[model samples]
Target chain A: MPHKVIRMERTRDHSSARRPVMVAIAGDSAAGKTTLTKGIAAALGASRVTTICVDDYHRYDRQERKGLPFTALHPRCNYVEIMEQHLQLLATGQPILKPVYDHDTGQLTRPELVEPREFVIVEGLLPLYSKLTRACFDIAVYLDPPERIRREWKVSRDVRKRGYTVDQVLAELERREPESAQFIRPQRAHADIVVRFAPAEGHDDTSNSPLSVELMLRPTVRHTGLRGLLAEIGQRTVQLRLIRDEDGIPVDALHVHGYAPREESRMVQKAIWSRLGLGDGDPVATLGDVGNGRRSESLAITQLVVLDHLLRAT
Target chain B: MPHKVIRMERTRDHSSARRPVMVAIAGDSAAGKTTLTKGIAAALGASRVTTICVDDYHRYDRQERKGLPFTALHPRCNYVEIMEQHLQLLATGQPILKPVYDHDTGQLTRPELVEPREFVIVEGLLPLYSKLTRACFDIAVYLDPPERIRREWKVSRDVRKRGYTVDQVLAELERREPESAQFIRPQRAHADIVVRFAPAEGHDDTSNSPLSVELMLRPTVRHTGLRGLLAEIGQRTVQLRLIRDEDGIPVDALHVHGYAPREESRMVQKAIWSRLGLGDGDPVATLGDVGNGRRSESLAITQLVVLDHLLRAT
Candidate 1:
């Protein structure tokens, strides 16, 4: 060899030197974390952002747990503490050897190393389920798909990708329902935004384009900015309806349909971009502030709101 | 609006004229079944072959078997009969929905529909462990790596591939050794050829190239062609003097590595082609006179071999 070569290790971004930001998207299995993340990732571009699945922290292999009494959803059954530590590490701009889940083989065949960048989106069944985990996301979201729709998505996926019979998939769903409801579903209350995607009222189980999105926002003084974000999102290419209901809950809901033409969906995505007031390329890069852990992010904004109040009083 | 569609059903090649040929490569875990199949597949070409791993037949999901007593290698832990049935179907030139395995991720994911074309290579730890299964293979080869070498290979593979620490892999190996000996290693006696890849005597562990072929020639005259086959093999290969002294078992003291170079190996393989003498095309096409459970290629040759007197009379 002519000379020894060295690839420089990536250093932390000084862009967030003044303040830290974090964003978390929590959801049950197949509850649109991927779909939602795609929109966000596309909007944000690549440089000032990073995203990861929380399940990447799982502790056991598929073959190892063949006849166990407890389900995977149980915290005791997982390496929860290690996962929490890794999340903290990633949030602080570090690399971690994330656990790999081969969805096709249903075996943890290999482990891959992941280097986290800036705007991290952590999505999975239990990102919002734990106290320590919840402390790591600045803006937390939980997907709340209707049971029927979620189960249907699961059924189709199992038949197509997994080697299970339709009957076996159904049986598994039944067995999993209790644990899902107990351990997974309730995490919705803890989220800053709750998203639900379901089939339209008229379409039951037949149509291919029944996918929809219903987002629930937690009530806070940030309504003006949130509404502006929704309005901008509405102006985008997609055919999404942003409905604000004053039904005593401080939240917002938006729904996207599989029935909507692709061209229509593109429009709504653009409107969300306009909220940041950028021309050529700064919509997603602007949302870098959203990556803070839930409680810490809350405290930061609360401090800002408090400062604003103190300034008005003075 | 345009309509989206699913993929079309695939077609299988069943020439309706001939009985199917089944080639079985039996070996312990990490014992080169996959490596051997790759060579055979390349030689035969993809147009005439389809290979399926027996590992995909695992019955339990990862999260389900946390505290189970048995590991996946135990026959009872897998759906062996279902796998055998599927093999028979594939051997007969039919396509079946094979299970998907994502070795990197330990998730029992979706099934993939595989349409069989020509050759079916079923490789696994227990491929030759069952009598009914043995009846299915037209030609069977066993991989017999020494215990020490196999252990080292398994360790490196598990750690690099499965996110496992060296200690965990070692524990798993220790646990499986007993079962591996009882179930996997014993299948060697049923093999037509036993392939052992180990370092030659006086060489260090760093020796990378090592292959020994122990031909188990059944005592029969029809196999007079067998000697010709070995001769052809010998042309491309070096024979180690594995002669048994008074003890009667030759393998323990022998170290037979093929002295033939790459070019010579190819020549030996070609010569083997000339000696089998089955009119060039698919010799595995017809079921010649099935007295035993085997799907024989030649009636007269096979009949002579069935009775022990064929060599003396001929």
Candidate 2:
């Protein structure tokens, strides 16, 4: 053993008296993980939150993946062990030097230092991919928008922002479907809340109606004050019902209708926000931004619900 | 809490059955840290050793440092917290995504994944700068060559390899002297062994004599077979004596005379190697390389002693 040295401690103290609350929002590509994460982070204030995308752990850049038999969706294409290790560090209120994967350039850039704040929102493809990863989160969410809607969102985002052709996006989507089913979709079963955004029943897909959202709240984690809040806000626009989950277990399904007037969603958001005991201010207005100044009432309500869970966990 | 998913475990297992033995080699810039580290790593076999330079944690690049009042020697100038966190990880036989500071380009480049093997050699300016860092090592070494020799080595190496002009190197050295005294030199007290390589006392400075080495072995850690080996090999070429250290404490000073013949140094090296119980073969031939095919007998002997400590620690 080496001799121990006793030196006066230096450097800014990074130890937190209380560990940061951790939330995981996991889904497949273009599944609105980032949008939902942005809302929760904004609600918590930027200084109090740290948001990280675990896709930055990709083992292969886009060009390298092209040469491989598996797509980026496969565990082999990512540094999953490193991701789990980082998550464990964050859950324990420590810091990590996180890797950066440039989505547009498809290159691994320099890493950035991530110091966990009062709240940490980890959103990516594999945040809930394993039991070890799942153990690091206080709340786990899986985004499961209708397949058609998700495909459309992917094409629009990649072509407009990521310099990919629509045809290229479609081809990539087709190639990733098998892995998506094998690796990504299976994580939904482990989530405390499964969120799906899609058109309302009997509504035309091409119509100008905003997407409605269904939040399946599993009993795995206690949803304190949520069921009562849902029951109190039970109008035509926001409703709560009992439904059988995929595992044939009874779970509460909360529905937020998109076409409902904005004021109704605001009422529900305010109702949930008030339960947080965070004062009388309305929820952040930017919660449901879907790009280009477009906002969805359903998205805002779903974000508020997730934010409620994060605060309760803390 | 999130529900745990019972999925088949995947990804490569990184947990080691036994933690890797860690060694810290601390010294000032151009103080033969890397040269010493290379010899040790080579002796241990590259596959069984992981060597990292802690200077990679620089918070600023060359261009950024120019605008600051302090040099890289300041603890604030580097990400000391992250470095300590990483050292703890490596000490526990875990992996780290280590940052890279490109010396040639003066840029912070992409991080590399470092997995600790049977032996880990961490060499850099501030490995022993703090108590937390010092606690991570099994054997701590400090290089303390004379000021003139160290300056000459710095100027030669930086000018030839790092693209710095002679005048710039000299000016930078003058600027860094204060911090070097305040930060770097004090770590010598915490080391298990202090090694100084310089010309023999009465030898002319301009002569081509190989640098002699004097190792100050502290009583902080047990130097198990070393005293007996020194007594058995006592000669004019290799002498062991007690000397009052800077702290006024008596310590064993082992001198390997650079003026001694090669056969005499070989005998000492062989004697140390045999006691390691590794094999009857001679010590590693590459242990004393000082670059450009040059070899130093004194360096080889010093490395053999350090290697002995590492093996004993395991």
Candidate 3:
């Protein structure tokens, strides 16, 4: 039919040009997805990155969900098909009038026009939930913070920022646990890199130390220069080890020590940045920003690794 | 690149399935596009038809456009790229979260979900404006009423239904004429069928008769069984002639007399409907409904001709 012929022609025309590199960072609510995405986009330069959250595909507002049988974490609560369609468009270097979900107001607001640039960072709970969406990404990352740390992060953020009481946030977290298990955590298996930020194991002074990061780098995508960089930087700041994953598959896990001196962590960051071929200079100052003028060297290093994958794909 | 490869695969998968047949009816504002689309959709049965207006792609609301240099009719005033992208999706039987423009309030309101069914009738100001969009339709129709008649229709509709003053409507129509000439009228050349409804030429009782229709059927599509059907209906009610179009192209012109008796028109409608293979019965009762309980035989016949083309393409 003419419909098929015309679409095939259009697809050929679209593919002849340069397309944007797509990166999906998926995790549960308050799992530091936004923080990780912000760091990567900053390092890539704001002008070259288009960042969007798939939570905007929510099929219901907060008020409507209160009466529903399932929580927002359920796939039924989202317009997953439209999400797939829009993601396909963005993945092909096209623009989309993306829907807006106002987290502060808990409402589905007016859509905004999003034009893909050199790179696109898609961060949300369901970015990697489907095969169609996962196919759109060149690099997929899943944030897997410890449950205790994540609960603390969620409580503090919701109370201070989202105008929710401590009890309400805790109750909602409990309500979402089952869907999180069924829908959110399973996406970890599809990611090329699974990042876990938590207090360092066997570290006695955890409260005074920053959260360390362990990146489980699967071989689906090449981790260029990562092993050599870790060796050069020394185990005092970062270490790489061969470990058996939960699935009993051998994988490389790179750990960035949170208790390491700031200078040592900066050295690790600098070494990774130098390999990026983005010219001879220090890394971007905004890479590790964690609000209120604070910075995390581990976060910066993790972002650099993700950036390296994106650039290497290009 | 993976982006190109993935998109090509997606396109192939989409084309392997059945896609919706798209029909575009394009014309200037108040050119009777919606009325024509309504009649065709009514004949096709509502369960199998999806109707959308492209005017919803306006980038600015009425208050915002008040201070702009151009009117809504200008190409730059609408999100033409997004419109093209969404049309490509719908043409392939995909759904879209379409934006809505509130005509009564002159505001851009929330978007709504639109899923394409068996037949999609896209009626609007610029559905056939671009090559990409034009490629999506199986049948492209341009409504080209005489400017005098169109202006009268616009003035009456705007003053009565849209809460516009007669003077304001006239002034706005004058302002839009240049853009309409530049951007809107040129699409008429791309249409497979050009329909004009106006007072019959040299008719003595024009005011007492409904508007007659002249359909210039181009050879881009096969107007199956039309000549034989017209011969059977006889020239007193409907006639076919070989005519040269504005571009000096030879085409078939079908004229339906507005003053033809209802019984004679029903015979023409039944002849067309029977050819559709929809079983032995009279044509649908709602084919020619105008607003406020009025019906036009000529309009019903024109809709039947379009329905014939749609079913033939299927």
Candidate 4:
């Protein structure tokens, strides 16, 4: 198996006796990692989950990296050792002075005290790139949207929120491609779950239709059997398949159709909710919805699957 | 495992015989078996495929079956022995004088000669119920739409095509429920694939939207890997997942979202065609496009999956 189950080695002095489970969400820039993290925190209840962006660990500010040969994707460009030490502390139920990088200003801003909660979600470009850092995570996910879709999302996000023109975003993508390949994409092979969200091939209403989602579940962890859930729904919008991964290891792949009929998705959603032992009302309401009313059922289900594991972990 | 792969006995045969690959699609009355069978035949090319409805094996005419205590779904109401013998004959590429059951007139019509072709799809109420008959097939599928959805479909079909009143059809469904459970539903466990088509939940425009489809791919047969095809299309609407079946057997399930964005479905359709080694034109144009221009992508994909196996068998 490409994914090895992590055994955390706690190394810290901490006040809280309770250990917080850490989850790592790693992906390239503008890969919706933050959006995913926010949704997860919301679903788990914000007070119970602490969210961190390790991009703040960059040793050099954006302006400083501009003069350097390497992009921020390089390990040398970031305080890798410090990040590793802090992760070790957090994994053992301690607090850390987490650094903050202002994405809008392209500068290292204020540092914040992060106390470990019941759950800690670390989302950034290179969370799983190192063995020491990866050990802090009980569950690791790699977001791998298609290049075209990611480009579109990144371009639009940068232009609207960060005062960058489309040309600048595209140029940055070109410059970061090599670094992303070297430092980021390889993390996918190590992930217990790989999620890809993309537009359906010929969808005319691209702006409105929910993006389809494909989740590859590596056998690093056992999953709650879904046959019963699928039977209850009796719809084909959600499917499960046993397949061989790229590395020729057996894995389970799950697909959630984007244009899933409302009833079908509801039945599945309810089934998942009940599985998680959650109460009524959509737990994944804010998930992947962002500014739009439209929500991806596949995305919600993906979140639920992860949450299901975390809940059962205790 | 509930589903066991069939191994042909290869009883008796004649001629310059190349054995025809047999497929059994079993379901309840008006469960869309004929429609599914038609699509399969069309996709494989009509000349190269032979379609058989085993409902013809009904030993009693419709009127006769009604007078008896058992419904048409009961095995005793059908000529099980002859049906099994003929299936064995057809399995090895022989011809049979198939009995005809006419739904329009509720009569046993003239028998027809059915010559085995490159592909043979046997679709009806109980094709998979008997072990001998099931062993004649290379692949078997069960249609298992939700009871509510099926009731609607059955009522609409019987009223429109067979001149049955709504009340009569509804009453018939009630009467046949017992036999359907005893003789038909159990066949699902024996099938290599179980298919369900239903309207999306909570949608106001249920009639306008295409029904979603879910297919459970049991380990009764080895399936052509779809990961490569999914990757090539770069769409998330069609997905595969590994799940445990009801019998605790691991299986792969595929779901095609209904109301699938046209582009998404088109991409999947194109991928399936290419997977089948077919050219640019759709080999399944007539598939699942029952009426209107609207087509169920899930249904078409289901057909393609089965077609993929049939084509590979030869």
Q: What is the TM-score of chain A alone in each candidate?
A: 0.71, 0.93, 0.94, 0.91
lDDT digits (tens) for residues B3-113 of candidate 1: 100100111122442324556778887775665565445445577667878777666656554567877778876656546545654554544445544567655554444
lDDT of 2 by residue, B69-109 (tens): 99999999999988988887787677888999999888987
| Candidates arranged by lDDT, highest first | 3, 2, 4, 1
**Per-residue lDDT of B51-162 in model 3, one digit per residue for the tens?**
9999999988999999999999998999998898888888877889988889988887657889999999998888988888888889999999889888888998999899
Superposed Cα deviation of residue B114, candidate 1 (Å)? 2.7
When candidate 3 is compared with the true two-chain complex, its DockQ is 0.37
* Clash pairs (backbone) in predicted model 3: none
Weakest 10 consecutive residues of candidate 2 chain A by summed lDDT: A1-10
Give the per-residue lDDT digits (tens) of candidate 2, residues A201-230.
778562367889999999987875888867
Per-residue alpha-carbon lDDT of candidate 1 for residues A48-144, written as tens digits (9 for 90 to 100): 5567776654455566656776566666556665566556556555555455666666565434445665456777777777666766656676767
Deviating ranges (above 4 Å) for candidate 3: A2-12, A202-208, B2-16, B202-208, B279-284
State TM-scores per candidate.
Answer: 0.40, 0.94, 0.94, 0.47
* Residue-by-residue lDDT tens digits, candidate 4, A184-225: 999999898898887755674555778877888888877747
When summed lDDT is taken over every stretch of 10 residues in candidate 3 chain B, the lowest stretch is B8-17
> If both were scored by DockQ, which would come out higher, candidate 2 or candidate 4?
2
Q: What would the TM-score be for candidate 2 when compared with the true structure?
A: 0.94
Q: Enumerate the chain B TM-scores of all models.
A: 0.71, 0.93, 0.94, 0.91
